[model samples]
Target: MRIYNTRTRAKEDFESRLAGKVGIYACGPTVYNHIHIGNARTFLNFDMIRRYLAFAGYDVTFVQNITDVDDKIISQAKQEYGDELASGAMSPEEATQLVAQKYTDAFERAMSDLRMLPIEPPGAYAPRATEHIDGMIEMIALLIERGYAYEVGGDVYFEVRTFGDYGKLSGRSLDDMRAGERVVVDERKRDPMDFALWKSAKPGEPSWESPWGRGRPGWHIECSVMSAKYLGDSFDIHGGASDLIFPHHENEVAQSEAATGIRPFARIWMHAGLLNVNKEKMAKSLGNFTLLKDVLTQGYDANTIRMLMLGTHYRKPLDFSDSALDEARAKVERFANCFRDAEWAVRTADVSEPSEVSELARACDECETEFRAEMDDDFNTAGALGAIFELVAALNVLLKEKAGALPDADAADVRHAATVIEELAGVLGLKIRSNAKETAAHAGEQGRAALRLPDGSAIAPDEDSMSSLRDSATALGLTVEREEDLVLAVLDKRAEARAARDWAASDAIRDSLREAGLAVEDTPQGQRVTPILSSPRDLAHGSS
Candidate 1:
């Protein structure tokens, strides 16, 4: 495998410190508020990287930190509640923790919505910075002992000049970093380029006790300390948004290697590109805020969001817009349709010695090989997605070519191809067939909404309303057992109304089905029933 090393600025052969083990740390959210789409782009891309590594047979240890204590969290706490809740007056620490936990919970929900890799040993794998204050203190002390850091008042700063490789990661030079020339430097520091390792405690902010009085870890120090604690002094990869390279990740390299006496803190540094909204940088303070929840509210699913993000390479800036999501949603629908059609062909198509089954399986194998090739080229996800759809298009042809049940061996081949499709897509952390989970979860409420249509006896598929579905299916000359089957039966009844020129009845069928989280398109092929990827219930709740 070859990975682009940001530190070296070249693609290098990737060899883990251990033969089969890989340790990766991606900087996670600060959790001051719900993450916007731009914030989620980094996490989503890294999740894809992790999934691909695991798919390649590596025992990957991935750890992402939650910055539960930060300047923003404290400030947000003060702005929201003013040091008091309905229960009573709150302490400064209590308010900060409250705000942090609230948004930390929000971050978790957003991660789930995007189907991020399941983090195990939740606490250790997703450590909070506040939980490792002593580790940060220990590192700061080591840096100070080595003359790379110094304490002033209650604040501790890493001395930029002492670290010879300070700008190696960011590719900045000492001359470019001269504070008075191009940057602003704190007056208390010995040099303009120095950065804080620990901040002195302030009146309404969170702080921790250490050898150097009470203060909190600086933003950059939190990741350095936590990653070293979990992934070891010298691990395989450290990653975050490209925006973090200059000060945050560069300082991490200086601090970690300096304190540990290690040449390289992380063998490879990967930084995902930042995202924009219609070519404008997305920032909450600028009123350009586009929360992930709001995107879901606009009736797009996590799958659509993932497709849109993967449409661009991880290292390239992504310009997001509604039209882009619409295109992504269409692609998602294409994949979903292929998965559904392949299953239907396997279940009911006439049995015959199909000419294309072996070819279909070959297509699967070729897609997998090509997928690995694309992903291996510096994690080129856009190219990988192209490989996926090529296979999708090929599989769709095979499914449509045959009209009857496949021969036994051929059916198994088709099934194997479907399995391959699911497996490869899962490597990208996408669900092709499991979308039914979302469909079923919100059936009850959407069923109620469907039943509320004017003069409509729509099929409400909730268990309480199953009898209505059964009667409707019987009237339509169908035996429906599952929710999807009932939806098909509804389409049959809707087709009946259309055939008889009952325009109102046809309109009611379409509207009622749409209300129940299904879309109906009267194509030349037939009345196509589609389960909307976005759930009405979930759209009410939560993004990228």
Candidate 2:
């Protein structure tokens, strides 16, 4: 697999320091507030990368750090709570921890809703910045001994000039950086380009005792220390948003390598592009940032958001708009419906014969091959998803034209195609199955709910209500069937049932629904039940 390395600014073949094993350290959230979609995008992209690597049979160890202490946290605590400790209230540390936990929970929920599959469970081995202060102090001590860092007042700053290859990652010369500098110059620094390694603690701020008096680790040092402590001195990949390419990532390279003498801090440096809103950067100051929960409230599925992110190359900037999300939702529905239909057909058809199966198997193999090829090409998810849609379209066409002629082997082929599509989509952490079923179930519910008694008899729902329900359900990945006067919710319940080995209960539910004038169909998305007719008695008695 080839990955674009920010250090080299080119796509290079992946070569793990250990054979067949990949270690990744991704910069995680600061936990001062709930992470917005832009921040979530970075984690999602790296999650996909890690998933894909493991899918390709490589052993992957992914480590993402939690930045528990930062200037933002300090500022937020003071402004919102009015110095909790000073008022004989909670301490700064206590206040920050409370807010951090709230946002961390929100972030984890967002990731779960988006169906992100971590190589390791969430927070499986996550190292918090505050927890690794010892590691930071040790590294700082080494840097000081080597003359790479110096103490100014109570603070320690890395001398950029001492690192001969300071500008390698960002490709910015020291002179250019100095020329464009806007922040007030600190005369204590040996060079204008030098950045903080450790900041001396201020009065009433969260502080830890260190050799250089009471202080906290700098932003860059937190990552270096946490990564080294958890993933070792060097790892396979170090990922973050594109904005960090400068001082954040560059400084990390300097401090890490200078302390350990490693040629490269990370073997691969993957940077995810920013998510733009209305041609402007998404930031709190801009007042244009959209929270993940707010976006979900606007009726876009979590999967649709994931699809929107994956629709663009990870390295390319993507513009966020309602229309873009709508497009993504539509695309997800199209593929999901196709998968569901194929699955339903496979289950209902008689597989007593084997003729024509070989041809279907060949087609399935071709589709899988195409899907893998697109994914292998730098995770061109857009192209890979296109390939999946193409296969879905082909399967739909085959079913429409040759439903009866499809051999039992052909059913196997269709199943294989669906499996391959789902597996590849999983690498990107997109749950195609949920999108298909949830939409259908919701639509079916709304359709049933809209039914009203006319002259004491049930009738079909109004077009407007049906349309609205369909749109909502389709966006949610559901299929709807309208009977004379009844709507039945259909979904795939077999997977859960089978996992628990409740075969009898699963089959009974299918039979019971069928007896109630509902046809139960199981698909990749889930189980779907369509009502054959509306029953006044059933509606009144809540029997169906």
Best by lDDT: 1
| Best TM-score among the predictions, by candidate number | 1
lDDT tens readout by residue for model 1, 1-544: 8999999999999999999889999999998998999999999998998888888888889999999888898889888878384345887788988889888877786777677877777322999988888888888998999999999999999998998888999888978868424657567999888889999998767678988888888888888898988888999999999988988899999998899898789999999998887677777877786788667545566778888998899999988877787788788888877887777767743434433547777787789899999999989988888888988888777666664755666666666667777777778876787442232122232343233221121222345444555555565567665644566668777989999999988887677666555567775456655555444435545542
> Per-prediction TM-score, please?
0.80, 0.79
lDDT of 2 at 349: 58
Each model's C-alpha lDDT?
A: 0.78, 0.73
Model 2, C-alpha of 5: deviation from truth (Å): 1.4
* Residues 1-544, model 2: lDDT tens digits: 6788888888888788899888888888888876777887888888888787888888888888888888888777777677566786887777777767766666665666566663345333567788888989999999999999999888999999999989889999999888876757789988878888888888657888889999888989988887887678888889999999888999999999999998788988989999899877787777888777556534465668878999999888889887787788788888778777777777865544433445555566676787678778787778877777777777788777666666666776677767766776777776676533231112232234333221121223345544543454354345656533333332233345556888875676566445544456664544544434332234323554
Residue 28 accuracy (lDDT) in model 2: 89
Extract clashing residue pairs from model 1. 349-404, 349-405, 350-404, 350-405, 351-405
Cα lDDT for residue 454, candidate 2: 19
Error of 2 at 10 (Å): 1.6
Q: What is the lDDT of candidate 2?
A: 0.73
**Candidate 1's error at 153, in angstroms?**
1.3
